[model samples]
Target: MLHVSDIHAYYGQSHVLQGVSLDVGKGEVVSLLGRNGSGKTTTLLTIMGYLSPAPGAITWDGQQIGGLPPYRISRMGLGFVPQERGIFPSLTVLENLTVAARRGLRGEWTLDRVLDLFPRLRERAANRGSQLSGGEQQMLSIGRALLLNPSLLILDEPSEGLAPLIVQEIIAILHEVRAGGLPILIVEQNIRAAFAVASRHYILSKGRVCFTGTTDELRDNEAALHQHLGV
Candidate 1:
């Protein structure tokens, strides 16, 4: 569903991604694993056109979408839920979701569908962003993204700043989304959350891909996992 080929990104003269490449097939859930400063987040930004790739191509469903603006890329069926969980502080939970919503090819991630996936969101339907707890805000963010009905979902650190129970809830919701046939690229530092959802894994080092394989392979190869991820 998505292909990133030899992509390079930089902030001014500081190169962040060096010929990084990976692919996510339809209905696949892929996790990007590494310590801090591994360029995993940079890869997602480049694909979404939030950061320009100096070299290499990002193609979605056989069409080139590398340099397109973030808005345009989003309209082309990509949804992003960053670590901060962007939400309008003044808007009610429903209103915030309505603002980021869209209709996509699958026609699956409707408001009702998302509400079904996250019943707690329905409970806080009338609450404003500022009124929500951290976990509630995260749920709102995921629901907002789902309303877009994206073919591919990019989640950066979904587990960050949440309680363990909330992390499990988020993981469960992600699995539900994956079962509905959306590809996902999860950039997370938490191994438990990543392992719970991702069937495939990629270990990055200094802006380059060091390994890409099944979760089972990564688990079995203790040396390789230790060499890069320190797992």
Candidate 2:
């Protein structure tokens, strides 16, 4: 349901995403993978309108949205969970999720639904964001995004800097979300986590797509895994 074609983006005068292209189809989970500086997050930032892409096009469900503002894109049913897990440090866990909640046409994602998905959030409902662990904060971030009831979810580094068990939990939650019919475009440094949930994977190098294939194909190609992903 999302398509990005040869998008180029820059930070100041330095080009960060050059000719990057990929897609996330309906009900499908797609992973964007690469080593650091390979433009994975840059591609996402560009797609979400934090950075504008020049000389390329981005269409969601067939409408061009390359240069729209972040809020506009978000209101168009695109939910973003940034790499930093952008939660309000002073706000309570319940407040963090409730503030971003929006009732979609179907209202499939609700605060109770989200809390059910991450039960720990319900337990910490009264705790401030800064009082939570890294894993809890990550859960809060994902929950807040879900409360938007987006058509497509784009998550950057969802499994970053967490315990192994927490990573596994997050991966399981992603699978559950995929099963619930939301298409996802995920950028992950954790190869195992990406493989666990995404059907198709794209590896980037120097802001370009270096490889695109199914999970099975990626797993079988040790060379691509080593050369592009350092796996």
lDDT of 2: 0.92
Write down the TM-score of every candidate. 0.95, 0.97
Candidate number of the best lDDT: 2
Tens-place lDDT digits, model 2, residues 136-180: 999999998889889999999999999999999999999899998
- Whole-model lDDT, model 1: 0.88
lDDT of 1 by residue, 1-231 (tens): 899999999988998899999999988999998889999889888999999877799999999999999988988989989778888889998898777763334566777888888899899999999999999999998888887878889998989889999999999999888887889999988987888999999988999999889989888888767888777
Deviation from native of the Cα of residue 192 in model 2, angstroms: 0.6
Candidate with top TM-score is: 2
> In candidate 2, how many Å is residue 193 off?
0.5
Clash count, predicted structure 1: 0
lDDT of 2 at 38: 89
